[model samples]
Every structure is written in structure tokens, then in C-alpha cells.
Target chain A: MAKNTSLYEKHLAAGGKMVDFAGWEMPIHYGSQLEEHHQVRRDAGIFDVSHMTIIDLSGREVRGFLQKLLANDVNRLKKKGKALYSCMLNEKAGVIDDLIIYYMHDDWYRMIVNAATRNKDLTWIEKQAQNFEINIDERPDLAMLAVQGPNAREKAHKALGNKILAAQDLTPFFAVDCGEIFVGRTGYTGEDGYEIVLPSQQVPQLWDDLLTAGIEPIGLGARDTLRLEAGMNLYGQDMDESTNPLESGLAWTIAWQPEDRDFIGRGVLQKLRDSGPNNKLVGLVLQERGVLRNHQKVIVDGVGEGEITSGSFSPTLKCAIALARVPAQTEDQCHVEIRGEKRSAKVVKPSFVRFGQSCID
Target chain B: MSNVPDNLKYTKTHEWIRQESDGTLTIGVTDHAQGLLGDMVFVEVPDVDANFNSGDDCAVVESVKAASDVYCPVSGEITETNEALADTPEMVNNDPFGDGWLFKLRPTDPNEISTLLDANGYQEIIAEDSH
Candidate 1:
């Protein structure tokens, strides 16, 4: 039996179809996934993402602890409430997990990690924290809801009332605490939104309030399509412990400046940066009729073979698109083998669609 | 909810077959199958002249979520294939019973059609699978 989230009953009440995902019973969709996808793009849509783990780190040595733990530099987070996206790497420079770290105060920070990698991430964090004076507190009593879209911030502000208006002016990748609610101007859908973290006891009421505010309740089905269209990397599929961030199209998240930040995987990352990675992640758009899917073979002329990690029909683009890891030398033109038949595809930089607009040429 | 046309016979695998007056058969996936597969991304149907035995894998329907094999409920020779699906696969997701008809076949033995389940029997199969 899979564990259910705090919103499971609320989801069922709203006619959600539950599916087992990462040892948790989650709502795949309420009714039409396409409608939900468009709703998040055009209007407001909310998702119950309490299944993800939230950890709060607080101590005088927290900055030092994070500088040594994460692949990216924590010193860059100078402004209070600012957030940084980084990857926790192993000794071999393989990506353990990618997470968002919020600098709440001088000595306190909050980290949100993927739900599936909760145990391993905690274990790794604990082993490293043993040498520092940091306190690792897992906030299991908190529930999270992500409301996203072009109108998401307005709708969220309406639901939160005047007290949360401070979050309205929050810059992107920043968080603000209003009373008991922590609202972050961040989301996975590549849209303007707020990811609200509040006590579990207040979640049911907040969900109802959001519904009353006309925010459509979305599910995991639409979430997958939206994230794929946004070109956001799913931790397990896009990069895992076996793959490095450089090959995963996440080199930007790595901070190599200041010359001597001795992060755990700095040596291997430096070596890989000097030599270059074998494969690179790119976005593929099918030129002809056909949908590129995961594990589908990609053939690039003069380069080598690669496979799509995430692919789907972009509702906004009205065509098939994909994220594939191919030979670093591969160029724009490629072919994807769909059902043993080669279909023409064009490779480009990612962020194919964002904020209800086309990001690709 | 879409109704299963009374004239067509369905299989446990959610395939509907229509028997023509001249003993020919036209096969397509059911609305239930398309609903389960979500968006149809690609499809692989057999060649027009290919012959298959009963219960053989003759076609494939790949969606963004999964890929499923469409089995032959009755042995037959493929007489015609829907070429339009190669360009617009969403036709299967939009109209699985009508425009999405996969292929036409001339049954090796016309009597094989009687072995397929009727609408009520196919409904029972869906009910059992849900549990």
C-alpha cells in the first residue's frame, strides 16, 4: 500500500483519479489533463505537492555547511529570502539531487528536495552535517501547494488576503513568510506562481479557499506535461546519481567561480569542465508527424546515438517536442526512431515554452 | 460516456471489429482504450498484405504514457491500412471507433468473428479489470 498525501481526501472529493507514484498515492488527474494543462498556462491552477520533503537548516555555521555540501556556492545568496537552485553531488561528481535552497536569515535556510529521494538525501545531509554545528529539522508537519499560471499570483494573493500582499512584491526565486504561511514566488510550471508552505492542519481550508478563488485543481498528469514543456529536468529521468550535471544540461547551476570552493564533487566537476562532457542535453522538435518519447533512439549525423529523457506534445506549441541527451558534437538536425521509422527532428536550446509563450525559435 | 455501437463486436483487449456484408472485417481500437492511453503520439499498423494468426501481435499504439500492442482477435489478411494515422495520430484519441479505424482485413475463416465478445461481454471484461 502506498502512503497518501494530506490532500488525498480532498483530491478524491474533487473527482481525482489516484495513481501510485514514488511510493505515494497521488492524483493523476481530475478529469481532462489537457484542460488542466491549459488552465495552468492561461489561468490559475493549484497542485498538492506536500509529498516533497522540506528541510530547515539553522545554525551559525549553516553557510559554511552548505558551501561544502552543495555543488553551487551559497555565498551568492546575499539577500534575505532569496533562493538558489543547486545540485547535491556525490564524491564522483554524479548528481545526487537537485534542490532549491532558500536563504531565510543569516543562520537559517530551507531546502526543498524531491519526494522520491527523501531518504537518501536526508542520510547524505546528516552524514555531512555531523561535522558542522547545523541543526537539520525535517518539517513533515507542513503541507505545500503550488498555484501557477499567468494569473496565478493575483489569484493566490486574493486567496491569501491582505496579510500575504508582501509576497506580491517578492522577486522571482524569493520567499516571504506571512504569519503561518510561507509563500515563494517559484514554481515548476515555468509560469508566475507561488509555492505555499503552511501547516498541515491549515491545508484543507487553504485548498478550499483556493478553489473558491476559482483556481482549478490540477494533478500529476498535467504537471508532467507542463514541466516537460517548461524544459525543467525531472530529477530521476533527466539526471540521476549515475549522471553528471554537465551532461544533464544543468551546468548553469554549478558555481565554479572564486577558484577554491572545495565542494564535495568540485574536483571531478573541474576535470569534466576542462575535458568537456561526452553527451549534452538538447531540445528536439519533430519536423514531421510523430511524437518523440523517452527511450526513443535519436540519430545525429557525424555525432552518435542518444535517447530522449522527456518528450511530449506541447499543447501551446501544437507539436511534438522532447529533451534528449545526444553526443556533445551533435548539431541541429537529427532523427528520432518512432516505431522503427525515422522521423525528422530539429535540435535547439530548451525552454521551448514558458509563461504561455514559445521560448524556442 | 460513449456507447459501443450495437453492430460491432468487441474483444477483451478493447478492440472493436465491424463485419461487412461481404464477410470483410474492419478493426479499430475502442474509445475506452484511447481514454486509457491518453494522447496518441504514434501508431504502428501492419502492412496491407500481411497475414496474421489469431492472437498475434499485429499493431502497436504508442502514447506519451505507454506503448500497447494491439492483438489480432481473429486471423486474417490485412486488406487496407489507415494512412492518415501516420500524419495525425491524435485521430485515434479523438475518434477511435470511426475515423481511427486501424485496418480492414479479409478474415481467413469468417466463422472466427463469432468467437469475439459482444458489447455486454466486453463491458464485463472492463468491469473485471477495474477491480
Candidate 2:
């Protein structure tokens, strides 16, 4: 049986179509997914992201432990409630998971990881913490909700009341805590929003209150399209334990400053960085009528073969877009084998849309 | 509850057929199929005048989540396709029975239509599948 989020009953009552995702029974859509996508792009929408794992690290040596655990430099987060996006890699420099870490104090930090990689991430973190003096605590007692879009802050503030003011004043990539709830000015949809983590028992009431405040409940379907349009990578698809961040269009997330910091996978990543990656991830826009799909073979005329990692009809762009791993030298245009026919597609930067606007020319 | 019009015929794959007065038949995916597929983004209709065997996958309906094949219910020659759906595939979700009709076919055997599931039979199939 799939696990249920704290708001599962409320989702069913609201007519959400529930599907098994990452072992959790989560809503795929309340109704038309296209409309939900438009809602997040044009107005405001909320997503039940409680399935995402939240882990808090505390101890005198927490800061030092994180410095060696993440690919990004947590030392850059000097201010309290500042968040950093980083990829945790294995010894081979292959990405294990991408997560967001929020620094609350010198000895206290919070991390949110992908739902599908919960077990693997926790195990890895625990194993790495054995040598350190930090306490690894997975906080399943908390539930998360992401309110996103252009008017997201306004609506969330209306529902959450003055408690959200601290979050409202927060800059991008920053966070604030109000009592038991922690609100972060961050999201995966490339829209201005807040991700609030609260006590698990309060989720259903908050969900209902948000609905009363006119915030539409968006599901996983639109979430995928929105993230893809924003050029965000999905774990297990864009990259995994066997794929390094360099080839997955995530080289920017790696922090190389303080050269002698000696983080895990630093040696392998340094070597790969000097030589460069063989295959690169690029965006493809289908020039024809068909939809792009994962695993479709991409053929570059003189370069070589590549494969699509994530593909879908972008609701915001009204066109088929995809992320594909191709030869580092491939550029401009390529042919994608859809069904059995080779259809032409335009190659561009991996992002097609952002902040409700088309980013691709 | 699903919309199973008593006047139409249905296949297990969730397509409905209506025999026209001129021995031709109009076909479209059932409302249940469209609901299951969510919003349609692109639809590939069979070419006019193409011949197909019964149960052949002749067309495709794609939504944001997945792509599903639309099968021909009976052996027939395609006569017309709803070209408007190429630009406005959402018709399949908005009006699966009326403006969303996929294609018109001149049946090879009009009697074959009688062998399809009736409204009651189709509802039973949908109920069983849901379970």
C-alpha cells in the first residue's frame, strides 16, 4: 500500500485524482492538468509537498560536517535562514541527490530531500555522520506546502495571516521561522513563492484554510511541467547515482572555492572539471506536431547519438520541449526519433520558460 | 457515473461509435477516456481514405501526462477527420461526444457495428476496470 500524506483525505474530498508517486499516494491533479499549469503560471496554486523528506542536523560540529557533505559551500550562507541548493555526490562524483539546505544557526541546519530518494539519502547521511559529532534527525512530524506563482505571496499571506509577514520580507533563497512553522522564499517552479513547513497535524486545516483563501490546489502533473519549463532536473530521471552533475547541466551547483576543503567526491569532480564532460544536457524544441517523450533517441547529424531524459508538452510554451544528453559539440539543430520517424528539433539552452514568460527564442 | 449514451456503441478501449444515416460511422474517445488522459495537447487522426482492420491502432491522442492510441472499432475506410483538433485538441476533453469526434469512417460491414458493446455493456466494462 502506498503511504498517504497528511492531507490525503482533504485531497480526495476536493476531487483530486490520487496516484502513487514515490511510494506516496499523492494528488496528480484536481482536474485539468493544463488548467492547473496555467493557474501556477498566471495566478496562485498550492502543492502538498509533505512527501518530501525534511531532516534537521544539530550539534556543535554541524557546520563542519555539512562542509564535507555537500557539493556546494554552506559557508557562503552566513546569514541565518539563508538557503543553498546543492547536489550530494558519491565518491565517483555521481549525483546521489539534489537538496536544499537552510542554515538556521551555527549548529542547526535543515535539509529537504527528494521523496523518492528518502531512504537512500537518510542512510547516506547517517553513514557520513558517524565520524562527526552531529545528530541526524528525520522530521516526519512535519508537512510541507508550497504556494507558488505571481500572486502566491499575496494569497498565502491572506491565509497564513501576519505570521507570513516575516516570509514576505524575505529575499529570494531566504527563509523565516514563525513559531513551529518555517517559511522559505523558494520553489521549484521558477515562480515567486513560499514553501512552508509546519507540524504534520496542522496540514489538513491549513489546506482547507488555503482553499478558503482562494488558493487552488495544484497536483503533481503541473508540478512536473513547471519544473521542466524552469530547466530544473528531476532526480532518478535527469541524473542519478550513475550520472554526474557535470553532464546533467548542473555544473553550476558545484562549489569549488576553498580548493583544499576536501569534500566528498572533490577529487573526482576536480579531475572531471579539468578535462570537461563528454556528453552535455541540452534543451530540444520539436519543430513538428508530435510530443517529446523520455528515452527518445536524439541523432546529431555528424556528432553521435543522445537520449532524452525528460520531455513533455510545455503548457506555458504550448510546444513540445525536452532535456536530452547529447555530444558536447552538438549544437543548433538535431533530429529526434519519435515513434519511428526522425523529426527535426531546435537545440537551445535547457530552459524554455520562466516567471510566466517564454525564455526560448 | 460515466456518460454512456444509449444510442451509441462502445469498445472496451473507451471509444464510442455512432452509425450515421448514410451507412458511415462517427467515432470519438469516450468521456471516460478523455477524463483519464487529462487535457489533450495533440491528437493524430487517421488519414482520410485509409483502410484499417478492426482493433487496429489508427490514431493517437496525447495529453501532458501520456500518449494513448485510439483503435478502430470496426474494419472500415476513413472518410474524414476532425482537423480542428490539430489546433484545439482540448475539444476531446470539453466535448468528447460532439465536436470532439475523431473521424468518420465508411464501414466495410455495417452489420459489424451490431457486435460492439451496448451502453449497458460498456458501463459494466468501465466499472470493472475501475475496480
Candidate 3:
């Protein structure tokens, strides 16, 4: 049997197509996926992402523990409610999971990790925290809802009421706490949004309230397209324990400052940085009429071969785009194999679209 | 939902076949298949004039999430293919029973058609599989 979220009944009531995802029954879509995708881009849409695991770390040694545990330094969080995106790596510098860590106080911090890697991440955190006076608690009583798009913040404010809405001024990548609710100005979609984490019991009402506020209930289908458009990497698809963040287009998430600080994978990362990786993750935009997809072969003239990690049709751009791991020396133009035919593509930096604007050149 | 026309036969795999008066059979993926697939991004239909056996993998449909194989229900020689699907694959999602018909076949053994499930039987299969 699959585990059900607090919003399972609500999702079924909304005519969702439920499927087993990471042991949880999740809505893949509510009717037309394309419509849901467009809804998040043009208006407002909400997703029940409670299946993601949230872990709270608390203790006097929390900051020191995090500085050594995460690739990104949490000390950079000067203000409360600031969030940092980082990759938890193994001893070999392979990415175990990409997560968002929220700084709440000197003694308390919150981390949200992928549902599929919950057990492994928990074990890894526990093993690392054994020497430090840190307490790690998984908060299963919390349910998360991501309300995204141009009208997302407004709809969330309307649903959450005025008291909680006062935190609406939070800058991007920041979070605010209002009693039991944690509101974050963050989302996978390249649009304005708020991801609210609240008690499980209050989830259904909040979902209903958001819907009443004219926010369409979206599902995982649109979530994938939205994140792809944002050039965000999906765990297990774009990178895993076998890949390092340096070659997965996540180098920016790594905080290399404070040279004395030693994170779990620092040594291996330093070596890799010194030696340079053979392949680098790059963005590819198809110049022809074809959809780029994962595992497709990429050919670069006078360079080595590579494979696409994530690919899809960009509804905003009305063209096919992808993230591929190509040879480090690969240049501007490359060919992606689509259905046994070579399709021309342009290699560019990622963050294809952001906040209603095109970021690709 | 459109009614399954009485003249066509359906397979458990969600493909429908229509036998024309000229003894040729037109086949297509059902609307239910397209809906489940979400959105159509790429399609790979077998070449015309190719021979296929029943249950053979004859076409490939790639949606945004994953790829699926469309099997041939009846053994036959492919006489014509739906060229329009090359450019407008969403036709399969919109009108699977009509313009989205994948290919036409001249059955090597016309008796194979008798073993296929009718609309009622196909509906029962879909309901059973839903569980």
C-alpha cells in the first residue's frame, strides 16, 4: 500500500490522477497536464509537496555542524529566515542529495530533502552529527504546499489571511515563520511564489482556501516542466550518488570561502577542481522541430561525447531545451541525437527562464 | 467522452482498429492512452509496407515523462501511415478514433480480427486495469 498525504482526499476530490511516487501516493496531474503547466506560468497553481522530508537540526553546535556538513556555508545567513541551497555529498564528493537549508536561529535550522532519499539522508546526517552536540528530528507532521506563478503570492496571501500575509515582503530565497506556519518565497517554477509549510491538519483547509482564491491545483507533471524551464536539476535524474555537483551545474551552490572550514566532500572537490572534470553540464536549445529528452547522445565537433541529463519542451520559449553533460571542451554548437537523427542545438548557460523573463541569450 | 463507434474493435492495450469496406484496417492509439500519456512530444511509427505480427512492437510514442511502445494487434502489411502525425502528434490526444489513426494495414489473415475485444470488452479491461 502507498502512503497518503494529508491532501490525498482533496486531490482525489479534485479529479487528480494519483500514482505511487517515492512510496507516497501523489497526484501526477489534474486532467490536462499542459493546461496545468500553462496555469503555473500564466497565473497561479498549487502543488501538494508534503511528501518531501523536512528535518530540523537544533543544538548549541548547529551552526558549526552545518558549516562542516553542507557544501554551502550557512554562516552567510546574516538574517533569520534566509535559505541556502546546497548539495550534501559523500566522502568521494558524489552528491547524495540536493537540499534547501533554512536558517531560523543560532540553535535551530531546517532542511528539506528529496522524499526518495529520506532514509539515506537521515542516516548520513546522524553519522556525521555523532561527534557534535546536534539533535536531528524529522518533522513528519508538516505538510507543504507550493503556490506558484505571477499571481502566486497574492493568492497565497488571500488564502493564508492577513497576519501570515505580513511576511509577503520577504525577498527571494527567504523564509518567514508565523507560529506554526513557515512561509518561504521559493519555488521550482521560474515565477513568483510561496511554499508554505504548516501542520498536517491545516493542510486541506489551506488547499481548499487557495483553490477558492482562484489558484489551480497543479500536480507533478507541470512541476517537472516548470523546474526544467527554470533549469533546476532533478535529483536522481540530473545527478545522484554517482555524480559530483561540480559537473552537475551546481558549482554556484558550493560556498568555498573560509578556507579552514572542512565540509564532508571538500578534499575530493578540491582535487577535482584542481584537475578539472572531463565533462561539464551545459544547456542545449534545439534549433529544429524536435523535443530533447534525457539520455540522448550529444556530439561536439573535435570533442568527446556527452548525454542529456534532463530535457523537455519549454512552453514559455515554444522550443525544445535540455541540460546535457558534454565534454569540458565542447563549444557553442552541438548535435543531439533525436530518434536516430542528428538535430542541431546551441549550447548556452542555464537558468533559461526566470521571473517572467527569458534568461537565455 | 465520445462513444466508441460500433464499427471499430479495440485492444486491451488501448488501441482501436477500424475495418474499412475495402478490407483494409486502420489502427490508432485510443484517447485514454493519450490522456494517460499527458502530452505527446515525439512519435515513431513503423515504415509503410513493413510486415508485422500480432503483438509486435510497431510504433513508439514518447511523452514528456516516458516512452511507450505501441503494439500491433493483428498481423498485417502496413499499407499507409499517418504522415500528419509527424507534425501534429497532439491529434492522437484530441481525436484518437478519427484523424489520429496511426496506420492502415491489409491483414495477411483477416480471421485475426475476430479474436479482438469489442468496445464493451475494452471498457471492461480498462476498468479492471484501473484498480
Best by TM-score: 2
True contacts kept of 3: 0.53
Choose 2 or 3, whichever is better by DockQ: 2
**Compared with the true structure, what per-residue lDDT tens digits does model 1 show for residues A274-304?**
9999999999999986567788999997778
Per-residue lDDT tens digits for candidate 2, residues A51-86, read: 999999999899889989999999999899999999
Candidate 1 regions with alpha-carbon error over 4 angstroms = B1-6, B41-52, B79-96
lDDT of each: 0.90, 0.93, 0.89
> lDDT score of model 2?
0.93
True contacts kept of each: 0.29, 0.94, 0.53
Candidate 3: residue A126 Cα off by (Å): 1.4
Candidate 3 per-residue C-alpha lDDT over A112-173 given as tens digits, one digit per residue, 9 for 90 to 100: 99999999999999999999998999999999999999998887787778747657689999
Residue pairs clashing in model 2 are none
DockQ of 3: 0.52
Candidate 2 error regions (>4 Å):
none
**Alpha-carbon RMSD to native, per candidate:** 2.1, 1.2, 2.4
Better of 2 and 3 by TM-score: 2
